[model samples]
Target: MTPGRPDPARRRWRRIAVVTAVVLALAGANGPWLYRFGSEKYHAYRIDRPEYKARNGRWEIVEFPEGYRQNTIHAALLRTGKVLLVAGSGNDQENFDARRFDTRVWDPVKGTVKKVPTPSDLFCTGHTQLADGNLLIAGGTQRYEKLKGDVTKAGGLMVVHNENPDKPMTIEAGTRFTGRKNGKTFVAQDAVLVPRARKRFDPETGRFLGNDAGLSRVYVEAERRGARHETGAEDNYRVQGLRGADARNTYGIAQKLALDKKDFQGIRDAYEFDPVAERYVKVDPMKEARWYPTLTTLSDGKVLSVSGLDEVGQLVPGKNEVYDPATRSWEYTGKERQFPTYPALFLTQSGKVFYSGSNAGYGPADKGRDPGVWDVRTNEFTKVPGMSDPDRLETSGTVLLPPAQDEKYLVIGGGGVGESRASTRRTRLVDLRAKNPRFTDGPSLGRGTRYPQSSILPDDTVLVSGGSEDYRGRSGSDILEARLYDPDRNSFRRVADPLVGRNYHAGSLLLPDGRVMFFGSDPLFADPANSRPGVFEQRIEVYTPPYLYRGGRPVVEGGPGTLRRGGTAVFRSPDAARLETARLIRPSASTHVTDVDQRSIALGLERTAGGVEVTVPKNRNLVQPGWYMLFLTDRDGVPSTARWVRVP
Candidate 1:
């Protein structure tokens, strides 16, 4: 050993010794609990521990990378069939430093991350992979710095220049605007990202204590950065991500709204891009101009852009505009959606748009409206069903997480931002299979907060990444906590946080490997140190299941394995929690799970108090032999736990 410290060889030995001790301790967390560990799906097996099995309830942040630019991820694509992945970043110019806008594409196999080139020197709001495999991104500048108001859209409210009331906070003057590097703009900004909350327990009293579930609050105040000047020019805008439902057509539509405030005449047009041809063509302009709307493609091949910043000057009520790609002209369709304001439009497998989560007024309710959903097919404007969760503001607040499936919408974390309730920090699980699909509040975050975006894997497990939480009566972001949900178990567990902070960003999907991709975004302006809203990004990230490294359990912990066609296994049920009853698991192992786009083989289950008993299906006689484990979990509805059995 060295005089003050151990030598490198000694340090290495010490690390090994520590790891061995940890492994031994984990093996004894409960007791020696072994059963056949094998599943037909992946042909794997292992042992089980109550503590470890419980860990599977949420994402396990096995590892994390360094903190990159000060931005949120907007788009991400895992390079399927390959080891690398690409992610796009969108930095908020008004609140973040511009430098964070740097783009970062990552290599999962090599464990290296780098940058990629964006098509334009502008902020990208949406991104997706084309059918042909190229990345498609769309966005416009906030009309700050080198970008002029004449050619760019204003981000904030200036009653005189206000075009959309739903989002009243308008971009001040672009003439005085500089890149987000100057650090001089936060002085008067008032616009804010929503907040979150958390739940805690008094250590001494052992009583539940509630708190905000978020990071520090950073308000955005609008200020004129340059002298006022106006020129007669044109402004163009980009729409949301890809819209065409069919893969063969590989076609998408984006809106380009040209507004010349000097002339008070607004121009609206749509552009069609052919991924196969690698080109873009302009479609006809609509009779009316709409902003902050959702464009959905129908099963009948019709494309509908619903409820936008209406030119008629009404904020709550909205008109639907239908575009016949073949016809090339936008037909003023019927008034399908009355309160179509900034709605999250998700396309269902049946070619219908699953609409949810929306802002009612151009501004907050006190200023006008709250949030809701409008169905276009039924011309429905009635109050949304199943989404009447209580909020602090009494507004309709729905935690719009990623889609659980083409048939189901996923709702993860959320705060009382739009609610009028005392319990502001909460998570939710919204099963969208009902006639009046709404939500069932999940376990409270023990605080009030909302995780805006979550990544849903093929297995139906959800990865809730970033969002805002309430902290110490102030505001904060949910960038620190993550959770996982297993329908079989119907429970949520605390997981590891991403290495860095991210909120109000999009989660992009990468196929084949089924890994998670995270793009970046920026919420602060002035000080490009963290981002470049209209410029660049420095990193991208991918989340792979630590299955191989986990050594056992497909996140089950204590132990798990693959099941064979003729193998039998056993499992012990876990105890109940606060009156929560448990579900029994049988034939614990799954032999044939689905592929990236398919389903997994279904096995049978039995119940036990310490755990569960597992068995294989009779048809397994024709199946191949392999290792597998049974999994059990409980959904609060029936208070039953889902159990997994191994067949190794």
Candidate 2:
């Protein structure tokens, strides 16, 4: 070949080399795409590939058949396989009064919602499951306030105490006053309460009551003092005798006015809901009226109530009490254990309660916000150290990690205290079995969230879903994506996202079939008008994890309907040889990121002739007395539909 040009044979070789180099470069550019396609189409079909099998789980959402009349502020899984949804006033006082259905029993199988009467406003309350399989719902709002303009027009006459006589006893237009007549209370839309000063009248000693008799005397005295003539009144003081009774006893003007008109107050009402009877039986009320108290069932079946706003709407002091089912009354524990409102407490195997460092909004941040183990017997608190971002975990989701044998707890995302509007993405786990028992970092969520729901799965994985990045779930803050946390790997994998966005007042619970139901979102704090469509989330959605899609679910054919603690039970399963594990999950009473009674117990399984012999733990702490869903999973991690078994 020439220096600058090549002969035919040499030129052919040069062209081949250039083509070869171009082909190599193109392959490198598209290599990842080709590998991905091959892995998905071919390698994924290889059942033995662990990596492919790990990616099999997905999320499925199903809408409810009907929506709730009121916003669902609280939700729980009842023992009858029904869902109990409670929403007192549902944030809309007017609408709630119109409909008057604050509580409902939703049967998922029947696709129906039955309204149940609620004695008090359960707008913001706490609840837990009792050992006798009853739901103990405690505390709630006594009433809700409405603006004068929002209420009907019915004004009461008031004696004007015009300190300045020069100014006419002029009632400003649009001034509001409440009046009572003929056993009915009315609001005065055009006048305010103004009483004139009297030489003999000691306002302090008057003890001005809210009744008509008391108000009529003031009107008569004002008339005697020529108050009507001075004002040139067209309408006489039409103060009919006060017919209504005052809810409170007080002397001050503000106090008297509050008594005259209804006002919101926290209540001491406590009751047990019987799912079978579909009714609420009155229980002994708490010693102090509570608005947002947490009720945790002890291992012995007694319930301990802690932290809430009192009847006067003030935070109750650290004093706590335990409820005895035998007596059907609450006995002051004599221990003043103060915890934040709706503190997430878990009963340990030793009967001690573990404050999971998670609390519902409302309490001194320092008092009960610290993660600790509280001994009810000794009234001693052992604080767990090393928890990051502990102060602002309000509305955060928490769970006693599965395989109850492992005493580990995980606290998920939450928001800051007192309208801080800041959400957290940090997660932490504390192993109670550890010697020091300090919280350590777990996997962090991709984004900060508040009000996330953590559901423990039969396969020992935790599914976290639904929360907002902001306090009240402002737009763009709704966390729609769901994730699964695998304990074996200590990692989170993104799953399917629920179409609806949930925030404050949202709730979730695992069902018997291993699916999780997400319901009850009150983003606008129950204001239906300001809430955008779908924000209140009256409709329910069921999330089916990917494991359900895999074929060949283990079949649990026969098992004892009732098993005693530390008892031996034989379960017949078609795939006994392939059965890898069995679990007993307590039905949860969950609301406000607080699941007081839910737990998972891993059963010891031994392959029998045609089935498996499962040994239930004798430890009441591990498996408390209640109804639990028993599930068996195969080697592929596919769990059978759970069977409800009562542990007496």
Candidate 3:
């Protein structure tokens, strides 16, 4: 004891204290790193807790093997319970040039991914689930956009006129048009078919009035890559390789073809991706080429395609068309209705289309920007009122709230038109069943958001998650928060935050297993300073809602493969007595924060001795003809794995 200065034990204790103090000092110097590591460990422990997950839900990241990863731009939940991930060129100009289009069929249950052959660059394409259970994908990127400084050639749209009443004319790709006034030659980038001119007659006199020239537009560029080759005024151009009356009948006119920025062009290509066959079948092309179009399934099961940049990179001027799955053909709607690119148009139970005014860039801001009910049959529109932050509808997410029979829609956060810094967290709710349906302010998000991904859960709650505080998630503004929106209470409950940030080109779709799968995020910059170009997020994330963590879930087994709209179908389930509600949720076809195909329809549930019987709605428009995921939820809102059912 008296040996404190000499004892070996005292000396060793002194050395231990010194080492502990040194370690503490070093840890203090690197506190942030140490704290972060501890916090992450705590988070991992907290989320793994059964009680925590039962309340707040859980998120898991699904990183595909390096060879299978892709910049998925669009996703669709097929009837076969597999997800179709499409990333044609994936916003990469190099891939587009290399003809490296990609599509993947991912089985979430089996955890397998298989690549499918992509025929065209389906980037920015419009897609919807068809009545035949095939996915109707139409229109896509024909050319990438070129910025002003990047454009080396003088180019603009050239309108070729056909004045001959006898026959149509074909202007092949690379066809030259020499200006008669300026003596400059320009080349067409693609083929154009100019129809025969229409000969008009007087209704009363029965006399020939005049021949109206038929016009077709094609994009043309100067032969030389110099400013001197640009045109400053409108000029008539003579069609090369044409002779006699044909030469005079077919001519070109272009206004001010200069070295300016060229917008992205679209193609008329369309296809039906058959989930059963796991292949794409070519269909009749669309009547008008489209980029960033919206395809809404009508009550009759025909998909209406509207609003996009055309072949010449100009707004398609309200010429909406429809695709008939039965005939595998598209036809003009015979009605003109203008909308911005990717406008949110939902078909209502009244057999009319409702435009939510939510759009994804392109077109003049002032025109076709009002939320309204559009009668496609009569070309009539009745504007709905009271949309908050109306100017910031761009990139907003619209969800037809659960039990779609109520016709209530929730429009989530959005930003201002095209690259504007403005954003809004305000959510707007509208009930079409009201005498005068108008949007009213609902619960707000925690922060300003854009490109929010909202998916309808089978339990009647909408999961609204992920967005950016800025345009295209510029300056590293991607928002990572998520919430469950309860339409029943008209409130939002904070959920577990997502592991990844998602913004432009991102989407979420509910899986058959009651989980939500999120894919794609294309940020504009990699850092807050916007110094480095951003990389696309290809890692898919699956969110398991809180309900999934509950002890046991009900089950839907052995249901009829087909159910009539007004008929009842019995499903075998041991937990039928515990089942509270049944929902027929339409599979999702999601892209660019737009998913009109995902709707949850409430079914009348009746518990039997050993199973449950569900009756479908009598209204065909209310329950659109399609393949749906039938889920039964118990008292705790825990849903069963979906049973595939077809509404015939």
Candidate 4:
């Protein structure tokens, strides 16, 4: 061939290049096949990625129990490496009622959940785990007029244990009051245990009988020290309590993983708790209260506080703060994209923070692309791979799952892509570790709502829990469904029908043992007179996976018992009866599982025979309410039969 003549192979290669480029361009511009949703794939995930999503999501729903309570989920989940822990305020309370505290632990391998015990009310959004294995519970007052008829309750924090993972927990509130058992203790309110001090006021000799402000002698004091006062399994390292604030900024967070722990160690920056002195020393102050702000502790040992309302609900204008544990001073970062308010600040193992979702600025009205990430290395708010879902509003949750066996940072359900208030049932899988890492829309929440949180298990399963089935004033506000997201399968399956319908909830992962623990919510809280349809669920349940079921395949719809300290909970299967019932168990090891039939059981920190624990579920939703055995009938008539349910 002549030197200038194009070789047949060369000509072929050139044609291939043009065709490949054209195909990709079209795919980017239109939907998958240019049919169904002519909208481009980029339009769907909000990020540019055609390669990763083509695979399957490992997350999938395997098990769903019935007769479970439907309630609101509003607490945060704590992970210790193996187990998953979740807690929240029940729907019974109104407007941040800290009085009703409930917690549960999930064992992923065994697929079982246990309820720990708490003494007084363990408020919602006031629970955290310390490095020493103790839990730091926030203390405060609970103002629920329905539960007690206008008599507002007081609040306090209790330190509980978690090492045993199955034992009951002992708790210590600031003052010595008659516990529910003793009969003279004040209920605690929303509590947060930060490295700080707690103070109270006491009149010279003020007693309840006189008009002494109805308060006793109180003064300034430290909540926790090197560990805690009167150490033990519960609160041994957990102090009395830190002040818990109202959940603002659309997405509520207190910056759980901050690198300042070491700084709070020997250094004792200007405004931190002095480990040696066991007191609150004057350290530098943050630029703001960081109300509901998400935080990250960079590997370099600095704290980044971003996006929350400052006392008022206005997105802190261009608000982003950074704290130096060494200096104990807060500095102003730059303006973040308007993403946080109701967003989740997720940090990967690599020390990067992913700020996703928030309706902070626009409650259920504004139509805008919420902000995404605040990169520390670049010290700027960068765009996330696929965050902007115009349809999903109030994307308040962003959890970082462990690296899949193949290695990926799996980012799941955030807000909705529909109207601002709706939980668009949209979830995405992200692999930030990849060179061209992007997000892929995994599965729709299917009847999903808003304010839900997700947790990852050892096998790499993501469990999604609680959110309002409807918006604030809209119908179906309380959602009663929970699902598992299998990243490998690239899909979602409803695991259990909630005994209780809940919204604005949180989830945590416990270590050593893995289980998905879900807390319930009640809608009668704020306004008892007006019953918002599908408003509350007052029970809790644990979805035991077959892997965790030592008894082998459980008979579908077989009777089971509620496990707690103080008593042994047992049940007689109603499989033969008309229906099954959910046994609401509390933290007491006494096994006082009263044969009660309802949606869910609101919970708080309670004492177990061995260590600390929360209230848990017996059977799950989809069953009926009554004192009977739990056995699967597989009757075509059972509600939501399409949902996954196991039979013995």
Candidate 5:
């Protein structure tokens, strides 16, 4: 419109152009920040949408108050609907030395946390849900491990022998043993009770046989810390403070005592955590100390404790025992069946223990690695075959599928034994009902995973989530993925991604409210480079599945607190007409990705006028005597808030 610069229109047009250019320049300088802000806003809006939640579910982080947070290495869902978070020394040597054991009871619904006074370091202990709704907790940290370079004292196992056949004797703690050949002295760290020598007799003719010395194992460390104090060969040690008959009756024998890497040691402490009282009730300690053991409830309501590092920081060597709730005592099984630490052993419908060959760690790779069905009474082990990636079973997650009658199990992803980098994406399914129960390849994960946590939902679906592609999340390999596995279809549906990365020391629990709670992740490193040490994940994450976002759930108003086996228990529910399935899911007592306590049992549901009558399974093995969350699901697959029920 303007040709000459003197024209007013031309000048006005030039000024407008300059203003536009300046505005564009300013926007370019702040473009990245503005884009990020807009993108975050859109993401928040999209995830919160009702339809999005209905399709993908939702995840929310729960951060505790500063004072209550802890490194939760073990978690159990109590009958009171609260979670027991146990840290013990929390893998912290300083805390162990300071005796700062920790335990917390967290009410998920009320959002309240209460601290409990822990009796000992229950780190790496074994736990199972008892018949009377108490958690039978056994074993713990006797001593922390020392690496090769970190070890300053020479210590090892010392077998004390008793030649006297008359009476048993106790070698008190602080008793010194002098090496007869090496002239070195070592002190016992704990008391050893040597039983009376057994007078053997020939069963055929009742002839007297030579007396066998009673033996007991005890750990001893050198009097002082030095390489010179280490023993290179087997040596006989004289019992100090003993004279004449006592000295001749008792002696000590040891192999090599060196400054080698010492493993984590265990204790014999046992407790029954009362959910009502919210405290630990000390019971008779186990005869043998165990760390990283697996406590499985037998068909007779006895808890079978098996496989762990003993007080001497060595494998327990098949010394299995059972805890009888009636006597509140532990008795040796009188049978020898060895397993690796935290072996995935589940009680089958046939009243036998089914070992999945999935273990945490610590055992000879060649020994006790086969999956089998073990008869505790008969000591029979029938090996199950056809396992894929058998070497990678360590750290794998084994879950018994819903409807306990099916006797089907899915063993998900695992890694190589003991910090090995090898991992597998394959999942193995075994149906024990089949005449030949063998592990068959099931659905595979997107990538290799270890320490994956799987929880059985009331809707008969399983939520498999979290794990790392590497050992202990090395090199920041924690997978932030979640999937809902449909047992009917035998396929996995990818859901919303988890905001947190979880690997070793992580587990999941199905809450009574139909949501799932995830806790604890002890990654080896925080950064991808793994140059820095990882911090334990203390903040909990609760997941609301897509089924919850669909519609109003069936509400279980009133129900009988106790249901006898083979008996029907009527529960008042206005939506009984809509109820199609009932499930009794045992609350999870999970640690190290090993949860033998969780099993979903299908209940017989008969719709009544104002309620539903549910029948319990008669088989004790199928329906373990314990507290379970009774959930009623409508035709829409929406499950009601669980009603606490005890199956007697």
Candidate 6:
């Protein structure tokens, strides 16, 4: 134009240019919205539904031919195609002490259950498959006690007097009352006052002592330190006579004494069950007694036993032991390698152990709860970041998805600590192959769950079933709907729901015939309320995936029952031309949402005249010495029944 003004012809051109500029700006601002609309419309017909294929698997309730003797607390798929079920009193302390038959052999093919005598109570024990196809079970509960009685009556309380004395201090039982003595903090354990003897009896130790003695003695030291005031005889008389009306004076009294030895004792017995001989042979016990421990098979074939309560029912966070199958004995690995009780530890391809952050019951809430890469050799733990809802993963299921070469780890549903009314539906995945491994959000389940079962299917998919939506299946939190997780798509599809609601103590395993069996569910921990009086879950159900219904399953005519490392396996299958994938899945020994020694490795497949030849990798880390289920899938992803193959 002319500096600030334009001529008539030039003004028209200027106006047109400004209008075009404005239009372009507006279009740029709305570009993403327009593009999204157009892209969605274009792909509307192509958007595929979440695959449930194999023809949509179905679940059927199957009754145990001669129902289980006890609730199924532990289950393992034997190399012989039968299942080994162990209950060990099934959380029934009375029955357990009475020597009830707690072990059984479940023959799925014959629909029969055979009882096996167990030497000790295997309740709350940990187990993993050894290289010889035998199960090494270790660390079980000597005894357990449910919380009972009034909060104040069992454990004495402590009251703090401050400027606001009228507020009335509310001291709860189990709350640690600490005092300062010699510049050190002293903690007072629970105690009950014996007014007649002018002393307190340590019920936990079954010993009567002075009111200010033993654990509670710290309170006396604290009184000298002026940390708090301990009311004397006059106050006790007024409080005890008023029927606890003046709780303030009694607030300093210790109610519940120490726990009894029988309540927290950990068993030292360790045994290896020979599935073929159907007998349990006692092995060298652990260096430290453990209850509720986790037995993990290391990449080098040695079993790592970590976490658990010690001889006295106390969480042993830093005391870990390694079991050498060669020596058939356990060696203490020191406290540095200690982890949370029942941590779901996965064997990485690099020979490192990955803690999946899924713990069963007991441990330090802060230390061993984080997911990390643990070097057993160096005792180094590298925490993996980016896990969602890590705090509430108690009893959650975790697994290294199929094609172990991918190096991906996944953790599914779990609940909060103790009796907290919280559960989670969150799932996370981490790629161990990454330079700095971190978790990423994965698929969520249909509902929040605790103690869910995740089983690796023959078709490289994971079937997740059972678990409660709340803590201990309260308020009808028992979930029955099952789901299938497809790693290829990173999505979850709803599968058929089972008839019984499995929660707390439930287990599942992949059957050799491409089916999945789900059993055991003790929601109340053997203390079923009057509303649901019967406690134990004695029923078993088998899930038949859609692949089974698909007509003409590729027949695995024959294959070597045993294989060698770095060996080639020639499988006789008439549908070799149609075969698309070959996979080897380790037999699962699953319990308490912990599936020990379960892994899937994809075998390199090559078509032959009438069968397929598969090359097994030589890496022992990828294919540890153990029994595996070899399966063949057709081009349609329909898998054939697995054939048991041992790599020894």
lDDT of 5 by residue, 1-648 (tens): 456447787779999999999989988998998899999999999999999999999999999999999889899999899999999989888999999999999999999999999999998999999989999999999999999999898999999999899988799999999999999999999998999899999999999998899999899999999999999999999999999988999999999999999999999999999999999999999999999999999999999999999999999999999999999999999999889999999999899999998899999998998999999999999999999999999999999998778999999999998989999999999999998888899898989999999999989999999999999999989999999988788899999889999888889999999899999999888899999999999999999999999999987887779989999988998888899999999999999999999999999999998999999989989988989999999998899999998887
| Candidate 2 vs 4: which has more lDDT | 2
At residue 317, candidate 2 shows an lDDT of 83
Q: What global local distance difference test value does model 6 have?
A: 0.74
What is the lDDT ranking, best to worst? 3, 5, 6, 2, 4, 1
**lDDT of the candidates, in the order given:** 0.36, 0.73, 0.94, 0.36, 0.93, 0.74
Pull out the clashing pairs in model 5.
none
Deviation (Å) of 411 in candidate 1? 2.6
Q: Write the per-residue lDDT of candidate 1 for residues 31-95, one digit (tens) a residue.
A: 43422222422222121333343343222231325543333333333222221222222434343
Candidate 5, TM-score vs. the true structure?
0.96
Given candidate 5, what's the lDDT at residue 333? 96
Question: How close to the true structure is residue 198 of candidate 6, measured as C-alpha lDDT?
Answer: 35
TM-score to true structure, per model = 0.46, 0.74, 0.98, 0.43, 0.96, 0.75
Best by TM-score: 3
Candidates in order: C-alpha RMSD to true structure: 20.6, 11.9, 1.7, 24.9, 2.4, 17.7
TM-score of the candidate numbered 1?
Answer: 0.46
Residue 55 displacement in candidate 5 (angstroms): 1.1
Off by over 4 Å in 4: 1-285, 323-338, 358-371, 385-388, 404-421, 466-468, 472-474, 477-479, 494-496, 506-512, 520-540, 550-648
- Lowest lDDT block of 10, candidate 1: 587-596
Which stretches of model 3 miss by more than 4 angstroms? 1-10
* Model 3 weakest lDDT span, ten residues long: 1-10
| C-alpha RMSD of candidate 1 | 20.6
The residue-by-residue lDDT of candidate 4 on 427-508, one tens digit each, is: 6656665676666676676654555645544334556666664443245455556666666577676653444444443332
Q: Candidate 6 regions off by >4 Å?
A: 1-54, 65-67, 146-264, 525-534
Error of 5 at 488 (Å): 0.7
